[model samples]
Target: MSDLPVVVAARRTPIGTRSRAFAQVRAEQLAGPVLRATLADAGSATGRPLDVADVVLGNCMGPGGNPARVAALAAGLGVGVPGVTVDRQCGSGLAAVLDAVTAIRAGDDRPRLAGGVESASTAPTRSVDGVPYDRAPFAPAGWPDPDMVEAAEDLARADAITRERQDAHAARSHARARAARDAGRFDAEIVPVGGVLADDSVGRAEPLLPRLRPLFPGGTLTAGTATRISDGAAAVAVVPHRLRGGAAGLVVRGHAVVGCDPALPGIGAAPAVLAALDAAEVRTGDVAAVEIVEAFAAQSLAVLGRLGLADDDPRVCADGGALALGHPWGASGAVAMVRLFSRLVRAGAPAGTLGVAAASVGGGMGVAAVVEVVR
Candidate 1:
């Protein structure tokens, strides 16, 4: 049996724009259904119920009670299946999946379910002292901790990513997403939740992108060029390659989490992707597919440019990305992996086909994973 960890199933709930389709759903409620669906799909693929060793999840902005355990119980995985939650801001989900992969590679043969969830609409209001705050500071007082938007704006200026280019990139994302959704390319990976059968944000941004004003004065980014705040959950089932039973799946190749200058946090994924690819002994041109969390058009373009990929490279987010699908913070990273699984595994790519999933984190960090298709 190969010691490599293989992902046999991937699933996600329809992404709902904040204060819309999933306004009343809690984080665990959002994660539970996807977890159940992913597990069932894995069981179907393997022809037996897996002895799941753990349930690991990434979350941000939820009520802090170890949401992973709550979500696990909610999925009826039984009390015996312990759960752990991780937080690396937007990169949490992919970090969780990599944690599971590390465990499996370290001689733990039992299967595991890992992913991320977020319910921005239902998150509790937080306060420090007598003042309310949207979120905790990503860096301490001595460190440069600009808001994510501000960081994106700085990155755009530094990279000379213009407003016209950003708008075009966003438009392309929406068009690709709408076309993929229309063709049912996203159907098999989406698990309906909160009565929301499909992503509510797709196909709504392309036409308005060019007309929208910049989010900040004299900035390249606009509301249309940024990912919508959303509610969603995404998960994948991981097990030893031996248990895959010759089924098609993603074989874990390499992963990395690296940090960069805090002031330009949005470009962090570039270094992480390079590191992961180097670890996997693969080059950017060798990758068949790539998925990076599209927090903002300028940010994504900067990352791609750093990695020597063209802005319109079809290999990157071929079916659109967070710009159209919505950004459910913690879930977006895991969502990237799920997208890769769909494009590579579900679409019947040849064995050894390479793919990459990556996300820029809030505190000047990036997380990325390299995976290969195996049958």
Candidate 2:
């Protein structure tokens, strides 16, 4: 591991529509290619897994217990390389990345494989998933009751997330995202996978903005404003180095994971970020950018208000966020990280680039991560 963990490379796949049944195969099938490409894009061996530390990953859906382990082995990672799979619901991807950073910064391990892979194609929608509040006998013990959207509505009512404010936020997302898509800001980060219906690579590289219709007439959040359920996976490789001359190396500095009540889902990330920022001793102002997953238009607005981030700030996902792009659950974290790293490189500002990615699961289960891009 470098004296400090620098993000040598980052890559993400386009958000996918699983139920749309676009003839796309399984989740792992998609994750494999992106995994290889991420390594290659970094000038590292994409196919040849590194010999450094461990493999860490997170996923929301089941069917693949220890997904990180399975993904690592399936994608040709080193044999016997310890693999860990964590479930932080929406924050699964960030959680996985953080786990690797924590291990390295704590000196428990160095040069580890840290990233997240999520495929909505593998799991059922929250409606059919029997997620506690949706039904009884919650087979998935960790799956809390009450859907994330319901929780967001509740929060908005209590916190005064005005419909107008939410609508304005959603509109800005579409406008800004469309602009970013036009400008090619996401070029360096997005990985073009095989199965794509859109002629352009990044899904929204070609605008479908004309079709911004909502099922409800006066809906506060329109289809243009919310994150779409998508299918895809993303991964990044991290290595350690011993910088000579007492220099702080360009490596991932560290990461943190915090626990909070699952009932309030969207706002759950506040505690996690506080703990992470404390461990890194970094402040929000010092952060160059944040990639908070936009689960819903209202959800994102609520989280931003709580975090005190300016909605129009250039530092937060300079390239359109999940609302404009899409939120593919497991795939979204990698997507945010990939874009954040690219922006950091272009800005050349922070020695330690910080990225914040948040997600909301049913109940109050929210996950957050703070990653530093060194080099």
Q: By summed lDDT, which 10 consecutive residues of candidate 1 come out lowest? A: 239-248
The per-prediction CA RMSD against the true structure, in angstroms, equals 0.8, 4.7
Query: lDDT of all the models against the reference?
Result: 0.93, 0.59
- For 1-375, candidate 2 gives per-residue lDDT tens digits of 345444456666665565553234455565656666655644442233345467776666744667777766666755876677776666777667766665666676455655666666556344445543322221257655555555666666667776667666655666666677677765655666665522122334225434555435544444544566667666766554441122222344434555555556677666666666776678888777777777776777777777787656766655656666666666566566666666665446456556666565544555555666444
- Stretches of candidate 2 exceeding 4 Å from the true structure: 21-23, 42-49, 78-82, 108-110, 124-144, 195-224, 243-254, 350-354
Best by TM-score: 1
lDDT of 2: 0.59
How many clashing pairs does model 1 include?
0
